[model samples]
Target: MDEADWLAARFEEQRPHLRAVAYRMLGSQAEADDAVQNSWLRLSGADTADVDNLAGWLTTVVARECLKMLRTRRSRREEPIGDTTAEPSAGDHDVNDPEAEALLADSVGPALMVVLDNLAPAERIAFVLHDIFAVPFDEIAAILERSPAATRQLASRARRRVQGATPPRQVDITRQRQVVQAFLTALREGDFDGLLAVLDPDVLLRDGSAELTPGAAGLLRGARAVGAHALAFSRAARFVQPALVNGAVGLAIVPRGRLIGALGLTFRHDKIVVIEMIADPERLRHVGLAAVGP
Candidate 1:
């Protein structure tokens, strides 16, 4: 084989590893593929005759690409508040391949991805590289162009949020997870009665999204009203999943595998009594998120 063919084969060998890194960094399968492809483009044009660690080189390239994409996404974000449009509207990569998507989901659970989505670009890169992949701090520091100590601090901060430093509310966490899971299942199945079943008779739904009107107009009372309202946008339930929101069980709306909103529900007598819809980007940034299960 020629030099180009030999290099192509080597790159193909590292494709999965590179894609996995990108996925954890970007939290979007489509973007991960793009980052990997971009890395390949760079690799194909570079001279690697003296390179002793091709895999490491490729990982760094893809990570940098992912970091760039993340920064761009943050700066250009313009989605409407409380946006619950759930559909697999991503570009052509592995969209039609459910098995591929499922594999990706298993590698990085929905809950963790939601938390990763809220992390700062540098912090996400640092944490994913150092913590998840076991990359060295010096190497990650090179990627972020910061000192190793600074990079370590970034990873530490991200770790605290991902692991949830604050204790959950004074309630039965196991029961709350079950209740939240049931509510999500009901919402996804479009079972109005199921929604009402888990919601208290006098449940109060408050809209903290910027899209809602102020004062009493943002509040909806009664199980019927809340259930009906949830069903109105039940399509979002398809992407919503149970997650640890602010140290307790809650729902995160991750349409197209990207977290955009979260539902903070308060329970009473094992029934949901208050539902808080938080969609403002700033508010979401401050909300602590952790994985609900292993």
Candidate 2:
């Protein structure tokens, strides 16, 4: 086959893998698609007389492109669509058996993503590539520009955080329902004291949309501030209903059944610590009402 035909064949085979990597790096399907397209353009135009390991070469090109996009985005002060509050219902899945459905549900559970989100960018990349996709550390190190030893360290730290972090214990559908129902009741009733009772003393509340202020906005630490924030939201906005977001307790808000926002809550030791409210309209597309009882 001619060089063009050979390259075309290889690109077709690598597209899905490249897209997956790009999506994880950029955290947006649209950006991942663009990164893959740009990689093809570069590959098509490059001189390939002495190039070896085309897959590695293409991946390197794509990684650099993704990094460039990240840098440009940071320089321009563009924030990601951070509203992560909506919880899609279980009915969205069309599983036939209860056991199979339960397993699938557990696989992509919200708690997993929350732990993943807490990871540093490099650590996340390394862990996802190595653990999720089974990519070798040497390859991941190349993409991350670090020694393989350092890459392993990054993955180890991410693993430790995920393993050590406590997930909510109420796995039964009915029990999860009760906990969230209680939480919503407290919020709706404007019972700040009651809400504080269920919150961890060191709870962290993050308004993803707010500008990052040094000790001002973004991260609100302590139960007092967290409770106050919840009270303020309860007073100002009306939450539609609770839902199971990525397998964690979540709530969706609709001003007029038009899906306005979502909130994903994570619990540790039966006390809420992290509250992520996603108000950006664009990010609400994947979220919907909760299907499970809770």
Best by TM-score: 2
lDDT of 2 by residue, 38-80 (tens): 9999989999778788877777777767767766766777633
Model 2 steric clash pairs = 83-278, 84-278, 85-262, 85-263, 86-262, 109-246, 110-246, 177-294, 243-290
| Candidate 1 lDDT, 199-273, residue by residue in tens | 999887878553333466678888998899889787767888888775457889888888899887666678988
Query: RMSD of each candidate?
Result: 11.7, 8.4
User: lDDT for each of the candidates?
Assistant: 0.74, 0.66
What lDDT score is found at residue 134 in candidate 2?
65
Give stretches of model 1 more than 4 Å off: 78-107, 165-294
For model 2, what is the error of residue 103's alpha carbon versus the real structure, in angstroms, after optimal superposition? 14
